[model samples]
Target: MAQTTAKYHCLVTGFGPFYRYTEEENPAWLAVKPLTNSIIEDEQNNVRPIHVSTLQLPVSYQAVMDVVPLLHSHPPVFHPSIAEQAARNGVARPQKGYDFILHVGVAGRGALRVERVAHKFGYNMKDIYGRQAPVVETAPLPVEPEEPGDVPEEVLHISAPQIEQNQLELAEGPEPTPEPIRPKRGFGPGYENFQEEVYSDVNVVSLIRNMKQQNFEDVYLSMDAGHYLPDFIYYCSLAEVIRSVKPYERRRGTQVLVVHVPPVGQPLTSEQVTTALKLIITWVCSELQSIDDTLAKERFQ
Candidate 1:
């Protein structure tokens, strides 16, 4: 008989949307009820596909920090719901820091398709107010295609000559155009006002900074914010967030990756489980590899 070793579980966190006041909405926190019992079924089996910890926090950073201490540090929060998830499960606080912290939430502004922006800005990590200094702002302009016959994009830039002329006209117009669209000043979708939303973080900025500082060759951030960021920009008065650290000099550098989330409405029926096992196994295995690399280095080595 083979001896079974306990697997290291993750702590996942989410928050309710308080700032978003509307009819018939429970905020992102409502998703936790379903997320808790419904295991993160990895149909692809990329490694360890299951999310061991799943919990939610309010949109408020302080409320989130009431549970997880690390998240309380500063503006861009780390996985704010991890502590709640760990407690939700019977597992005592681990003897060490979490093997991984997975935070899941609704990406509100994701409706618009901005693969190029997501890809261009890389992780798109921003500050608490959603504005970063040194970044020039201008009205949205037509994106130049990367290649001929290619699609256009909306990467941030402030070099528009027309925006200069156009904003002048608009500013001189009716009361609405006094302030041109700008960071924290609102220039993107749904932001017609002189102000915009707050900027939160999944820690891509610090994580990238750390990787760069360490000169880690193969570290890449996995992301899932999708196109929702823009929508959030409108109601939240938030700015697009991205890491500020430059990767340390190295032969090779860190590359952040965005993972695709499985579609909603997963059924826990036996039929699905049987077919989905392969994917589950693969995801678990990949996660296992990540773990083995750090905690189980000897085994992997």
Candidate 2:
């Protein structure tokens, strides 16, 4: 029988405008924003319900550094209605930390990519602010501030660039202005104790296969998440998960998966991307629920 009463929660984040995406809302946010505060259920597959919450993040290293830790250590509260629904279903309120965190970013045209790895060292590309992550001897897992006063404002909220609401077009903005030069930071020559690369816990190969079976033609598994904002955020999220899991665990890596979607109307509309997200989320949730069921059964036997 399906665990119809079980509910899974996920935190989905999308990047704000940057590069050619500055004029309009980012395609990532356009697709992710609609799914915010929504619940997904697959009755046919008997998949548990999934509650999703979303927040828009700026394309800056500082912003990501400030935010990812809070997400892992102290997740934001979901809608009251979601809680009421869970209560009505007779499921416990979700505990600390989300079941998964899906970070979506804009990438090449016409293809949807499920990124498998995040690198600790190659963050060479500057953010929209013309600044890059500083070089470090080792990759440090972000720690939530022990004192509330120590938390930075950026950690609490990031304001997106002002633009007309719901506007998603390729229209050119005012003449391009040269970005001011900012000091560059490095991530050291080599990754030492903090392993050079971290992979996602999710079976991305299986994910792509399932999506293809469902007619999501353009989805592919990607090894390279690039050396940009997407990569930066992915590393932070993966690292956070690494820090939480015990060393003895048979399965490691992270529940964090980064998906790269093409710009709006580049052979795929935001609506299309949104549908893909629902399918992907459903598959991921079902896999996780199965794992939980196995663990629960083994505990009693």
Model 2: how far residue 139 lies from native, Å? 14
Give the per-residue lDDT digits (tens) of candidate 1, residues 17-111: 43443212433333334444334434343343333444554444224224444422222233544544545643324343344333334332212
Local lDDT at 273 for model 1: 23
Q: What C-alpha lDDT, on a 0 to 100 scale, does residue 270 get in candidate 2?
A: 92
* Candidate 2 weakest lDDT stretch, 10 residues: 161-170
lDDT of each: 0.35, 0.76
lDDT of 2 by residue, 92-183 (tens): 22455678789999997878989999877667788889977875654457986578677787755644442433133325445557898544
Off by over 4 Å in 1: 1-4, 17-31, 34-51, 61-92, 107-286, 290-301
Residue 224 of model 1 has an lDDT of 31
